[model samples]
Target: MNKKVTILNDKHQRPPEFSAGSCTVTVYSLQPWWRVDLLAQYQISSVVITNRVDCCSQRIDGAEIRIGNSLENDGNNNPRCAVIKYTSDSSSYNFSCNMIGRYVNVIIPQNGTTLTLCEVEVYGVLGAISLQTDVALGKIATQSSSSYPMFLAPFAIDGNRDSNVYAMSCSYTDYYFKPWWRVDLLIEYQISSVVITNRGDCCPTRIDGAEIRIGNSLENNGNNNPRCAVITDIPAGSSSTFSCDMIGRYVNVVIPKNGAILTLCEVEIYGVPAVTKKINLRVKFHTSEDMIDSTTRHNVFQQFQMVSALKLYWTQEPELEHENKGFSDPSPVHYIQR
Candidate 1:
């Protein structure tokens, strides 16, 4: 911009340092980043960036665009949506970031990098539709193995998101093969997503490689269920939601590794209740199976019962036209369709 840029259009050619027509400039630093807080969560769809058009537009290359509800590591630790690998051909670049977050961060990952942005625009829908209620709250939870009483299984589903294990101790398991934590939803649910809060006091990396699984099968202690997502990394004390989109009565967080301990500060499950389908008719005559399902209370065995014993009265006389004109007709076959 003009060296003498000032406020509004009253440029001495001196634009104000923090307003429109002015650019954000950072001094010599390592991996510099610029971020904007939207103050509320949003399901971001895209981001449009206006690089310094006056000069040095090439400096925006290799910069990563991140989005998430985290301030850890200056918000650079959030999930990356896109990287500006080569934007030399244009000063205005748009990136598709279909992410949900309250903050948008643009950072240069290398050492000794400077970030400059004239404008950054983020687009998304309000979070009212993106956020949902927690289904795992106050539900029964269990772990593969445990040695500590304070950090036992139930702590993860207590509706607490405190990341500090020292403050609000999280659920944890003993160092065992394929350590896992499971929550029984009691009823099957069509889970849409799961948010897990990692321990912030220490060992946040221990949560990595954990898989979120959802299913009714308890094979391998529920660890064998279909996976929703694998834990890569969530910033310290940050809760990240993994889209499950699976139907199950149980949700498991398992680390498919030997001699590893699993810890979770909080586990928030969100989804709608699964629609119940009519069970198949349990046609049985002399089988030993229960006559009624213990859970569904639906008849599980065929029972022979007589239909209504109705008296039949018929008149085939054409002289009684008024009485027989609006009469009902009934036909009975020797066999039933159902």
Candidate 2:
């Protein structure tokens, strides 16, 4: 009977409002080239969500999160999803999901807290893409010196000839083993034909069977000789001119059966010329194994310049210097008379 006057007020305190202060959603594409058709796949490792709330008084029993293109519960059925169980003391929670879209959104909710959203982040892995162009050797011209063989006419070859010869044989003991700078030739009689042969012991193998083109045509043997060539029927005792498309150390020429006198003109050949134009060489990182380490890369660059400096010096006779000095020395003066 005493309980009739007792009344208790039960106030239902609204559930503690919980909210995520800041959240970050990052996406990364592992492929080299981004292709939508490939259905982009990614590893979402650091999917962290931060919440600003008091964990001591109210405890968070559970958390619900959704990430995808659409915001629905099923959310476009994105192939990726992230869920987290957080406590009041938890500072940040991380989850991972894989999806194939250019955009993604993350929604987070706590049992006793208001829903929070993080800024959307999009990421994708693309495949390596590159393009390469062929190195081009521009038009090359052959020039003949004024002292060209009077019997040889300056003939141009378009590189069609089989045994085409633009120069005659000449030997320099000093340059026998070393590369030649240039060649000069003089002919006294009319040159009937020209043929080039590899005569020097150190002739570059790359020169063998190489075609010499003039303008745009090939220099070919009109008679189908084993060597590529061009023939001219100049009259006897007359001078003709000829030139070489490329500078080389030595070239052998075949005189006609009547054998006319041919002189070695000036030769302009030497080691590979230094590149004056800009050149770009790029290296890409494909994998840990394929990556070129710093040490190895530096060594390669150093070796290139070292080899370029090592020029080939031909052997020479000691007597040649004595003779040259004798000819070049000026007359000795003992005393002057007034």
What is the alpha-carbon lDDT of model 2 when measured against the actual structure? 0.26
The lDDT for every candidate, in the order shown, is 0.70, 0.26
Could you give me the TM-score of model 1 versus the true structure?
Answer: 0.52
What value does the lDDT take at residue 164 in candidate 2?
16
Highest-lDDT candidate? 1
Instruction: Kindly give the number of clashing pairs for every candidate.
Output: 8, 58
Worst ten in a row by lDDT for model 2? 1-10
lDDT of 2 at 37: 21
Per-prediction TM-score:
0.52, 0.20
**Residue lDDT tens for model 2, 118-224:** 32222333322212110111112222222444212222212111111333323222211211111122211111223222212232232322222222112322111
Error of 1 at 189 (Å): 0.5
Instruction: After superposing candidate 2 on the true structure, give the runs of residues whose Cα lies further than 4 Å from its correct spot.
Output: 1-45, 54-61, 70-80, 108-113, 117-338
When summed lDDT is taken over every stretch of 10 residues in candidate 1, the lowest stretch is 1-10
Q: How high is the lDDT of residue 47 in model 2? A: 35
